[model samples]
Target: MKAVGFHEHGPLDNYDLLDVPTPEVGDGEVLVDVKASALNYMDLFAVRELDNYVPQYPFWGGGDVAGVVTECGDDVTAWAEGDRVVAVPFLSCGDCRFCVRGQEMLCEDFTMMGEMRRGGHAEYVAMPEENLIPIPDDADFVTAAAVPVAGGTAWRALVPRAKVQSTEDVLIVGATGGVGTYAVQICKNVLNVDTLYATTSSQEKAEFLRDLGADHVIDYTEERFDEAIWKLTDKQGVDVCYNNVGGDTWVQSMRTLRWGGRLVTSGATVGPNPETEIRQIFMRQLDIVGSSGANSYELAELYDYVWSGDVEPVIDDTFPIEEYMTAFERMDNRGLYGKIVLTQE
Candidate 1:
């Protein structure tokens, strides 16, 4: 099997294409012929072994995959060969307390597919049958690959954790990236939020966010986003703040929230820091909620929206499987609007 992976931690240039043995199916597993895979910032972080996190040598790196099942282990009954499928990226121990309560994202043994184990960056992958979700026959593999991680994650963070309601004002930070783009659309279209504020670093992205349903777009490079958000909301502050960016933005996000409002966070791409103000928390009585990746049920609901054309996956670029370096370059340069796909061909 042909695959792209890295043997040592460094940069995207360290990745290489090579011939590796195909993974074998285990009991309750399904073997998929990977057609497409999507890239995320986590992929780059894993490759560099940043934050003392180390992936196995020659590590395969892709979590979101859409492919056709070629084989299924004996114990698997939910799906069979030749079925098209998308999968939930998180792998958790079923017996854990969190798993039993349907909060698998909180499991002590929780690990992402591409981060902690072999992922779908190759021609084939053998995953637990429980992770597989069938994709409609008409769905494009590239688009399907784009959904599992980013789209599903946005759905869980904004819709469920934040509990965004109709006619409420919402502010989304980093509104042009994969998760941010999904957040902007879902809040505007699905939740029917009255006013949507989004932040972007560039004028083009600000315009793009407006097209995606943001009622107000702030160019952070040109002005302070918190001040702009306050002005947009008439000094009352937004009802909810969807923040994935960390560092300074995290602290500002709390300030942007109205009294008794919620701040939902998924990832901190800007790196972590201790910047939260205790005064704001106690004075405003704000809710600080943390969210991770989505579960199978959330993935199913997100897929339904995708299938119905209510939400669309944004594809920045597509690279052949062997061109992992190029894909990572695009990701590192922040030159993409959404996902960078690697096609198995």
Candidate 2:
């Protein structure tokens, strides 16, 4: 099997395709012939081994994948060979306390694909049968591959983490990236949020956000988006603010929220250590919630929306497995409107 990996995590220069042994299926696991996989900021961080986080050398590093099952291990009755599927990125011990309560994302053994274990960056990968979610026959493999991490994550942040309400006015920061595109659609089509505000760096990206159902798209590059959002809501800020871009934006993101409003976060792409305004947080009775990627239950529900076309995956570009370096380059430099996918064929 050919896979995109690093001999030892260091920098982008260390990443490339290497001839590696295909993963074998284990009991309750399935061997998948990977068709397409999506890249994320986590890929860049993984390749760089930021803070010495890579668990081992020659690490496989892809999270979002859509593929066909070529073989199924014993005890796997729900899936079989030739089944088109997408797996939840996070692997958790199913018997744990959190898993029993349907909060597998909080499991003590929680680990993401491409981080602590072999991921779907290759022609073949193996995953637990429980993690597999069926992809509709008509769905594009590349698009389906883009869902597990980005879309599932958006579902987690909105439905469980933030508990976003239908009557709430929501604001999504970085509203043109992979998660942002899905976030906008989830808010509009699924959550029934009528007034959606988004922030993007370019006018073109802003237009894309509008097409995704953002009611107001502010150009963050030109002005402070908090002020724009403040005025857009007639002095009453949004009921919920979804912020993943950490940095200076953290403190400002709170200003976009109304009194007692909630701010939900998933990732910190810009930088993690953002100075907080504790006084404003206390005075406004704000809730700052941190959420990780979705659990299997959330992924299942999210995929229902995907199959229904309510939540769609937006692909920025597709690169062959061998050309993953180019894909990584695109992800490193911002400005993409959606996901960057890698194809095995």
Candidate 3:
């Protein structure tokens, strides 16, 4: 099987395209003939071995996969050959307390598929049967592959973790990035929020964010985004703020939240260190919620939304599987509006 992998943690150029032996299905697993895979920012982070979450050498990096099942193991009865599916990226121990409660993302043994183990950046991948979700016959592999990680994470952050409601005002920081693009669409179309504010460093992205359903787009390069939000909201802050960009924008996100408002975060792209305003938390009774990947139930909900056209994944570009390095370079430069997909040929 041909796959893209890295023997050492470093730059994107360190990735190598080589032929390795195909993976085998275990008793409770299924072998998938990967049609397409999507890249997440975590893929870049994993390549660099940042934040102590290091993968062993020869690590394959990709998280979102959509493909057809080629073979099923003895214990895998729910699916069979030729079944089209998308795998949920969150891998968890079924016996864990969090997993038992349908919160698999919070399980003590929780890990991402591409980050902790061999992922779908290959011709074939063997995954546990439990992680596979059926994809509609009408959906293409590229669209299906775009759903698992970015869409799932957005669903978890805005819908469940933050509980964004129809009439509430929401602010999505970094609204043009992979997760941010999904968040913008889902918040507007799925949740039907009253007002949506999106912040971006680029004017070109500000226009794109508006097309993605952001009611107000602020160019963070021109002015302080918090002040813009305050002005737009008439001195009142947003009901909720999505803080995916941690260090670079966390303080501004904190300032943009109304009293008693919630700030939900999933990733720390700018580095996690943020000045803590202890008084703001206590005096305003604000809620700061940290979220990870979505659970099975949330992923299922996200799938339904995608199928129904309530939310759609934006693809900046698609590359052949062997061009993994080029894909990573595009991602590292922030040169995309949404998820970058790699297709198996």
TM-score of each candidate structure, all chains considered together? 0.97, 0.97, 0.97
What would the per-residue lDDT of candidate 1 be over residues 35-144, giving only the tens digit for each residue?
Answer: 99999888888877653544456787789988999999988999988999987888889889989988888898888888888788889999999998988878889999
The top-ranked prediction according to lDDT is 2
Give me the displacement of residue 152 in model 1, in angstroms.
1.5
- Poorly placed runs, candidate 2 (over 4 Å): none
Ranking by TM-score: 2, 3, 1
lDDT of each: 0.87, 0.89, 0.88
Clashing pairs in 1: none
Off by over 4 Å in 3: 50-55
lDDT of 2 by residue, 38-126 (tens): 99999888877453656766887889888999999999998989999997889999789988887788897888898778789999989
| RMSD of each candidate relative to the true structure | 1.3, 1.2, 1.3
> lDDT, candidate 2, residue 72?
93
Compute the lDDT of residue 55 as modeled in candidate 3.
Answer: 48
Error of 1 at 323 (Å): 1.9
